[model samples]
Target: WAIGLLEVAFSRYCPITFGIRTMGLMGLAYAHYSFWPIWSIPIMVYAFLPQLALASGISIFPKISEPGFLLYLFLFLGAYGQDCLDFLLEGGTFRKWWNDQRIWLIRGLSCHLFGTLEYLLKSLGISAFGFNVTSKVVDDEQSKIYSQEMLDFGVPSPMFVTLAVAAIVNFFSFSFGFLQMICGSDDNEGLPLQMLLAGFIMLNCWPVYEAMVLRTDKGKMPTKVTIIAAFLAWTLYAAAFHISFSK
Candidate 1:
């Protein structure tokens, strides 16, 4: 979807027809396809990167004292408020909406991030995209496990690794930011939003945390996957620290 959106936006064309034709209508169509997918990139970046920076003792978020910061906050709240209203009008419960938000964050962190990377690689002619059809048929042993009400491990493990690392990064970042604010060792007026974002991501990460430390089923995260996630999170922190030091 990300690559397709980029292609369509760059070409300024829409291949899909909706039984309507007008210059303004066409413009709206183009904007819908083009702009919506672009949101995933920033959502993915903001979900993890600033937390990583905070973990590394470098704050890159805007200060609360900045005039534009309140505008950004208002915009964020307005968008989410609209979604909440829509959900309520559609007879959706708040818990379901909350879960929906969690899924959005998860997809942004995993598939959307991967999609953006693949799009970039494709643009640079360093990667080729192809489709692989997965078979739905299961063998006798697999069927037996399914009959026992066991969960399916349909998602790729690497995605779980990414989620695990994001959760870990958010956890420590929120903790560190809180400590810094409490100790008054750092100028932390800018950290409230960052900490709120970290807390929000961590709240949505309960399932990931469960898989990592609680679940004992086949769908539970493997020990090696946790180790890899930890290493990657540490690597991101180290890189951020080095970059801050160099600056």
Candidate 2:
């Protein structure tokens, strides 16, 4: 559904629709003609809910008006609840699984934000370095050290640069939005929802912020990466200011 929305939006923005259609055809071929397992009916229905809701400007059930909080509650239950169920099915206790899954909330945000940065970099002609497999065969001593300290970041990479930039951006965005709310600025009223959401997202990203700046362990961002990230962030802010104010 996300891909379909993107296709529709892009088609509306640009005159060229051939590429979008071709990509959609390729995806269908891979799913149906290739070895990929066809998605179950329930999975397809669940995936279409968000797009359907957006198109109809209502929840899945048309008879129910003003879904409001119930919409968000059901969305969360349909999504993350399945993961919780899976953990229980795998012989994991609910209490322990719930505690462990709390970290993934932050991780999901991190992955999406960094993934956006990666796409942005690619658009600017930067080639992505392929994925590296993390070693899972650590010794007992190494495991203990990692548990007490931080994950190893001995090698500097572009991924770290992206993460640092995102952390700094979230920090300042949340801080400024919070200050505006506290000051009771008129502008805050106009964008209260956005400001509150930014604050919530920043809270979710607290762990990334700690790893980027606060932690002084081997996993902490290197000085050079921090500098580059700060510079890129400043450049982006300056560009945004120019575009907004030049009008």
Best by lDDT: 1
lDDT of each: 0.74, 0.50
lDDT (Cα, tens digit) per residue for candidate 1, span 1-247:
6667666655535534321244645667666756455666777678788897776666576788998778868887888889988999999988778878877887777666666667778878896555345577787765865786544443455657788888888988999999998899657877877887898788888778877787776556788888899999888888877888898
Pick the TM-score winner.
1
Each candidate's TM vs. the true structure?
0.77, 0.51
Candidate 1 worst ten-residue window by lDDT: 12-21
- Per-residue lDDT of model 2, residues 141-233, tens digit only: 557657864444434766566556655665665566566567786534333333433454455456557766677755566788888988976
Residue 11's lDDT in candidate 2: 49
Give the root-mean-square deviation of each candidate in angstroms: 4.2, 11.2
**Candidate 1: count of backbone clashes, pairs at least 3 residues apart or interchain:** 0
RMSD over all Cα atoms, model 2: 11.2
> How many clashes does each candidate structure show, in the order listed?
0, 0
